[model samples]
Target: MSHSIAHQARPGHKRSEDGVLRKLRPLFWNQEGRLRAGYRVIVFFLLWGYGPALVHGVVDRILSLVMAPGGQWSFGIWLDPVRLAVVVGAGWLTAHYIDRRPFSDYGFQFNRDWWLDLVFGMVLGAALMTAIFLVEWAAGWVAVDSVFYSNESSVPFGQALMAPMVLFIVVAVAEELLTRGNHIVNFAEGLHSWGHLPAVFAAWLLSSVIFGLLHIYNPHTTWVSTANLVLTGFFFGLGFVLTGQLALPIGLHFSWNLVQGNVFGFPVSGKVFYATSLVRLEQRGPELWTGGPFGPEAGLLGILAIMVGMLFTAGWVRWRYGDLSVGRVRLSHCENRLQGR
Candidate 1:
């Protein structure tokens, strides 16, 4: 009735009311021709992360009762994948419909180079970890302990490799979706509304710190380890910000964990895992140098290794793309680049 009376007052009054509504409408959608990128970027994770996790929990309870352990019921072990997928899916939907952006804009596309990039990233990640291990061994910071759980699994050694790889693959994908996919890209663009390059740098710093915080609850947490994680996060973020494709970063994350725990039998950031044929490491030197129970990434050697990885990645991006800038790319652009290989 109030609306009707106000409308009846004058045709000129209706125009004024619409102007007010237009101003309010932007709270949900960016109608002012601004991206309001941050609002959209985190909205899905903030609002809907728990709902899916709750539903997944309930489903797992039912599955536990209905199926045999480590059979079809074993799917519960993969819950992280599902939990992270909910956020990724929500972001995808938002990007597709609300943002009206190509999927590639989010730094994803399955092309010829996709497999190569993934494999290369995996190798590079493993190599970096190996380098850290070798350096520590050479320096006598760590000693080669007895072989840990050497091929004692029901699955053969070759197949056992897949177990950790698969787990880390899910972890890598979920993290990429959370940080590089949602945080860095969205924050960069949103900050760009204020200034261009500075905005991107700010986003990089902010996301890297946030990424470090996310791991704070892990076992054997320390100031040194935490700081290393922050730096490592930045290192990973550089791969994406420079290449604008998450393939390298995703692979790096996956293999780093796989080799850290599954292959090398070190505490992966204070968390340990079991798998087939890999020698265990025992830190013998100063805790600060070896990271002690916290893992290599927390140690001085790990920090050195991470910085070197950053340099290598920067060099690779420079060689590949002439210059590294977070320029948006179309799906066709991604495909065209892959065609040569």
Candidate 2:
């Protein structure tokens, strides 16, 4: 957790004759003395994925040529794993081989606190979802008929749920890796090299904004919902920075959706579920308070709940790791390589 005070610039001043290269060095390279974080990030993604997408395109063309005049497989599934590998694989390779940096630098170390932190995040997420639902119900914005699980569709509810549950799990994994694990880590490393003390806010905002925008096209999305999603994204990102790994954030993301949509009888970003819950309620009116089809995530109550959760998480971080000081990461001469070994 020890890091260098990277933002500190040398005391001496240089004139224009110091050259244009000197001026440019401050922008591109980590002149403070570390491998350029931005460069590593670029190499990471390139290594993780360069031609798989084009390869997929070629496969589709071959299918069209062979199976039928115009037959083609779905391109969506192909994008899934390749995207995940681009981040997770790239991060692992960059840390272990190319950079020769410790896994802890990127928060990949799986030590004793891993499961403990993950479980804690899930519990907090579940509580946040529950609190929002309760607030809506108390305001009479939501009405409960009874505790019910539907099994009337083409697939029996009992048998049907495991897939969607698994799908949500996949979503949590892919998104956490893509945003918090890859993007934020890259930005943070770059910011650290620039000697930014509190890089968390900047990195978290960059990742969270993208996270919200990604969900902007979902069913029943609203401006309010997008903003709310951005807020939740911040909470999600907070877990990673607070704990320095993806486990806590992944756990929070998965549990929030499961409890919010499946257990609480609310639409998750617009998709409804019939999973087991203590109570089955229906939203009556007041779209803002109840969140309409977008679920409580788009509501004011949900916003308050997430802020409360963030406070709780902040407390947890203080209790577990002391103040939010990860300090600085130092690099040796040979440790600063372009490609990971």
Candidate 3:
């Protein structure tokens, strides 16, 4: 009698543990071992939103007290690195804990394969951005100039190289961690199977569009510039989908900006406008072709170039990573399992 009672109690204890596991499921489990939206939102707010603002306040006050009589602090270079580290680490760690995801899922690994993909993607992305510049020149929309900035001072070749590297880490790793890693996976997991793709695209659009809009305050932004940004977002999102890995898109993004803003001395996605850029332009032609005050990115040629790039990269990713089919590809299946869990 006693033995039978003990056996029955053991089964009951197991049931309680199972129940606990089920409740904790959402915390640890994600679709395809990726982070979810809840995790991303919390981290983004903590790092990008609040963290930077708070740090800025501190730095501003410190500068006010310590600056030379007429010297004003330029927070551009100083604040950027701080924000980059905080935002990237916060997003990564938050997803790891809250969504119960692995860091590799966010493309933190720097394996040979990843480096190869990065190099390829970077080259490809730069070519596309450059093609737009060429079209603008051919159409007589702009006259070429060697200097992108009025200032003769070089930005220290070392600084130019290092800046883009940091920017790449923030843009690629941080953005991937927040959007594709957590937000996309979460939506895919939460929604019905049939709704997964739509959900993913919707999230992609929202995230990408927001990214462009945020740059509105950069330097010279206009309606055309903003539109081009939307296309860029689409391009970036497509890369994320096609590769099923974040590193490729990051590489592409870094290269695009490096070439546009640093190498060519052109506006990056129509944001930063310097006078003496490596690729200089004097707009003597049409606004549509030249991108007007918005930079080259505003032109029709710019949009076309981006679309071409998107299609080419998409094909490459498909060739390398396999077709984007449910279960056939791991990322496609991630959202499904996350929803189930």
Candidate 4:
């Protein structure tokens, strides 16, 4: 009689434990036994925010041990790479451990098609900047101050241009990885789990808004600039949504900044690069049209460029894919896992 009673109590306790787990699972884990999208996003951001500072501190300390007391380090050269590594690690860890997916699933599978799209994006970006430069020049809104100008007398012209090129490349890759690759994908997955189609639109809009907000503290930022940056984010995200690849956006971003600030001598989002430029230009047009010291991004001309770019992006998608459609933004992998496939 006592043994039978104990056995019955053990089963009852097991049932109670199972009930508790079922109740608590939804808070942190999805049905697939992976961390919920929201929690994964939170973890990714926490890593992104704090990982860089921690790594940088360690790096500085390591360098200090090897260098003279007063030796100076060139921050511009190393800062971007360090941040890039941190962000890449954050994304990788979040995808592998938390999201239960591959990091390449975040739109970075490099292949022939990806490279082709990237080249096209770069050309398109360069063309758009060239058009802007021509229009401003034709309207007498801009004046050429010098050619192959370097603000730093000690840095050679080639070095000046090369430095900014490398910087812009790093910036393009890092920003796209964090903004479109991680944020948009994660937001879409989270939202999709709740509602289907509306989630896609909401995810895009939210990510773009966040992208703009990230630049809120940039030099000479205004409401108009912020709005324009949001629009710019949408433009950058267009190719990603259509093709599920970062190649287009990353290439476009690189060339856009490279041409805007380094080639054409416009202030990149209001921060003038004092390093070097192929041409030094002076703005004489109305601030409303030219974006003034804030550069083209703050003005009507920038808006026009962005509109044209959008049309071009849509056309490219239609041409390449034979239709304009959203890619794997729905995150079907989670469904596959849930189905045990």
Top TM-score prediction, candidate number: 4
Q: Write the per-residue lDDT of candidate 1 for residues 1-341, one digit (tens) a residue.
A: 99898778888777889999888877755533544666765664563456556868877777778776545423534554665566567768766765566756767877766666667678889999998788778988777777745444454566555556666776788677667766776676555444545666787788889889988999999877888999989988888777677888898998888888877777888987543437766677787777889888898878887888888888877776688675532222322233224
Please list the residue runs of candidate 1 whose C-alpha ends up more than 4 Å from where it truly belongs after superposition: 1-35, 69-87, 148-160, 274-277, 328-341
**Could you tell me every candidate's TM-score relative to the true structure?**
0.81, 0.70, 0.73, 0.86
Point out where model 3 deviates above 4 Å: 1-43, 56-79, 147-169, 192-195, 216-224, 273-276, 325-335, 338-341
lDDT of 1: 0.72
Pairs that collide in candidate 4 are none
lDDT of each residue in 89-190, candidate 4, tens digit only = 887888888877888888889789899889988998999989999999999999999998987666678766766777788778877877788777777777
Question: Superposing every Cα of model 2 onto the true structure, what RMSD results?
Answer: 10.9
Which ranges of candidate 2 are over 4 A from the true structure?
1-105, 145-148, 151-156, 273-280, 326-341
Q: Which stretches of candidate 4 lie over 4 Å from their true place?
A: 1-24, 57-75, 193-196, 336-341
Per-prediction backbone clash count: 0, 10, 16, 0
Top-lDDT candidate index = 4
lDDT per residue (tens digit) for residues 145-240 in model 2: 666465434545555455446656667876776677766766765655344434555877888987899789899998999999988899898878
Clashes of 1: 0
lDDT of 4: 0.82
lDDT of 1 at 84: 58
